[model samples]
Target: MPPTHLRRALAVSATAAALTVPLLGAAPAEPAARVASAAPVVPVVPAVPVVPADVVDDYYADAEGLTGEPLKQALHEIISTDVTTLTYSQVWDALKVTDRDPADPDSVILLYTGLSRDADANGGNVGQWNREHVWPQSHGDFGTSPGPGTDLHHLRPSDVQVNSDRGNKDFDEGGTESPRAPGNYTDADSWEPRDEVKGDIARMALYMAVRWEGGDGFADLEVNDSTGNGSVPYLGRLSTLLDWHAQDPPSAAEEARNATVFEDFQGNRNPFVDHPEWVEEIW
Candidate 1:
């Protein structure tokens, strides 16, 4: 993680760590908040085969025909158990699959910017990239380590500058024009990712809230419509996120990434990406 000083200026909440999710539109600004690639390099990213349908079915069998909060809860219980945890270091390698270029399997794409860079730079610093905690680490006092800190479902490869700009801003509509990344906008309270990853951001946050289940040292992550440098373990503007999820839908990048993660990286699946209908079913 960037040095503690670089972390967004956050007050010691009841929990002491930083509050994640930007809250500029309606909530007050924190007294000073803060804050991929790709190519056909012949299998640039370690290709992860798709998880078998039967395997995925067996994995979510407990929630069959389930819907609403029960389905949500059941899914939480199901996905929360038997997950293979990876170290924060392993995340760097995992991104190669989760964020690969949709157009070219040989390369990985950066989130937000949607720029396709060389896959050879996976670990090399040729093009600067950092692991972006979509849920924002401090929200639950989770640092850059194992467990929630390293979960591949929510972590993504981001341009270093764009990542910093996003900070821990909550998700919402309306913002000053973003100069840093086209299609990106920021205001006093929140940051809007480019259209490309709108559904992506939504799905990741939703997945975390579902997967963590408030157990196993995982913060019971929540999604809401509130804003600000929230100290609680939740993200906001659920209504907007829902809209984004619907408008953008899942793309080839997301499908491939989900399969790769389940088959290779974490041995689990992002239910929302695997089954977008679950968003409405649960919410």
Candidate 2:
């Protein structure tokens, strides 16, 4: 489901944004019911039937010439404003997109152990669940227009501090310096990019940086630069770990847990977690 703020981003009709739902993880089956005790429930549409490979290829081709930030913009434009009547958030909300938590082993069993589900099982939140742009919006990438397909890249829910520390800088294997936001506290050493979720963060960041290469708004953002003050570290450890993760994806167990958590909270599926083949299989 799209955030309230994102819904406003697309002031036109709210049809598409309203359809988001969870993609991976453990969420209650009856989605419409409220969860006051938990994170606010954002309404969204159920998953669109997975498109056939040929259709997917066609869609990918349509998205061709789009990569880095420009590609992301293209995707955002398609979802939020391109359609005129349909907002990006509306589409995402109706679908339910979420990020996964590989830290929890039970996460997989709680949802689905593999791509195949049991008779009684279903996927968790992939929407509404935060697919954080490793490169932040503050730096100005796609302008927060949430939707499915190519737009989905550059997002992955992660620890708030982790996201804050990253702040649109590119993921580098070298150490990093402190953030310009002085109050932002990130103990580069304490920050563990090796953490299960870190891998997800790394891949998403790389994808976004490549997608938004030429967007006028993001040129100033130093995607791969350090703070220069020697406070952050050389390349952020998280950035380096992400490189490794992308080269070698998590194990089946990691995939399951991330998928489960994503399902429960956001309401959608992770193409990376679901189909490892989409990326190089080093891990």
Candidate 3:
């Protein structure tokens, strides 16, 4: 009934509609379905949040224009202000979160071995992970109490045997390679962590030195130049630790861990982690 040109147009329109119908209604190809099913699902880790500039500014407001022991004392006052101390038992749960593997939520990354193990696999067993006091509790004699003993800033998850092997040794440069933790070296007097975490270890030690200044009934912690500092509330070789701090700057994970301690857990930030330049300025 239509004109010839109109009929041709209608036919073309109908052909397009017909072609679209199959594409719209059809299931995906069997090959595609099978390929998708065979593919592994990658887990997603939430990105670490950056600490706001104003927050850092305000936190260190009282510490401005200061250097050397005065700077150290000011920072000590700043970090020690209104801190929330966790019990030693609560630290178990805290490390599981703070040191959680970015690639796997259910696992934690060990400090020395760098192994990612199941979060619940924390204990004294040979294959498990346990709390590593980066600042040895024995050095300060603050064993398992809520203050310096349980501070999360210096606490980390570590392989059980590796933690034991690292036991209270002052950090220094060289030794035989640690048995299970490659890249780490240990001798009778000192233990050097793998290069990657050397700055992390140093900053934690610095933080302890600044945070606990012989007040609050806790021993005054310090970083000196000697090793074999048995139960003296001091950690050393300072010059070596300073080198480690310079050699390996703060990593993103370390910064994020610092933020987590400040924002979520400890209500205080590690000044060395935030302002690494402060290390050279002070020591």
Candidate 4:
């Protein structure tokens, strides 16, 4: 007879072997040594895809080789041309499509909370999503008019309370982490979006600054280096926004949202989304 310890090991191995065997000869059972030494399975995470080059070909042709104010001007001209505006009412339907969750066709992704909620769950009640103006309409006092007020490029669905928490606050780093929306922080004067969408917020601000150059009846939106912009046609902490733009490059989802706005809802695109490098070039 085998030694006591050796016999115990053999018994356990025999049970494992028996359990692993197929009722009908499915295939030979893996050797005990092979099974014991096998590596743990790691789930594969797919890489974020990039927008095809052809989609942006000649779209920014007029803004090429330009920098600073000239570049800003060129991009504004490029994106502002023939934009189809939606009504404040239509924003509900447009956001259902623009910010729709990729994994769930019936849901849309909330901006600050990153929660995927049902498309129809929009209202002023708690625990629901509503349109969030990336560039607060009050800062520029655009209200809910059909122009900048309804621009799909800047509007997104966000949790109701989270939207109010971020109300009219400028973007910056550091604050107490929000209880309602983790990863986001807020101070008296500024609201810092979560890291994943920090670049998205920054790009939206930059796009607003460029697209609304005070040429139209609306206020001339601009970016500044300070906070507490309060009803002014400016958003701030530009230096921080620039840092965010570099830290978080455009994601595949963001690029797709830009394309949807251009191809379906809005007739124009957010240039910064298409060409992130142009942010530093102009700002």
lDDT at residue 149 of model 3 (Cα atoms):
90
Per-residue lDDT of 43 in model 1: 17
In candidate 2, stretches whose alpha carbon ends up further than 4 angstroms from where it belongs are 1-49, 60-96, 99-132, 138-152, 158-191, 216-242, 250-283
lDDT of each: 0.67, 0.34, 0.75, 0.73
By lDDT: ranked, best first? 3, 4, 1, 2
Native-referenced Cα lDDT, model 2: 0.34
Candidate 2 lDDT over residue span 1-283, tens digit each: 2223333433423332222222332322323443433322222223432223453344334345544445444443332322222244443332232221222211111111111112122223321122244454544434555322224443433323334555445344434333321212234432333323445555454444333444433332233434321222122333454455566564443343333322222222333444444333221
Candidate number with the higher lDDT (1 or 3): 3
- Candidates 3 and 4 compared by TM-score, better number: 3
Which lDDT tens digits does candidate 4 get at residues 38-139? 211111121432234665767778888999889988888888886767799988977776665544556666777565678889999987789899999988
Model 2 Cα displacement at 222 (Å)?
7.5
Off by over 4 Å in 3: 1-48
Pairs with backbone N, CA or C atoms under 3 Å apart (clashes), candidate 4: none
**Sorted by TM-score, highest first, which candidate order results?**
3, 4, 1, 2
- lDDT of candidate 4 at residue 29, scale 0 to 100: 28
Predicted model with the maximum TM-score: 3
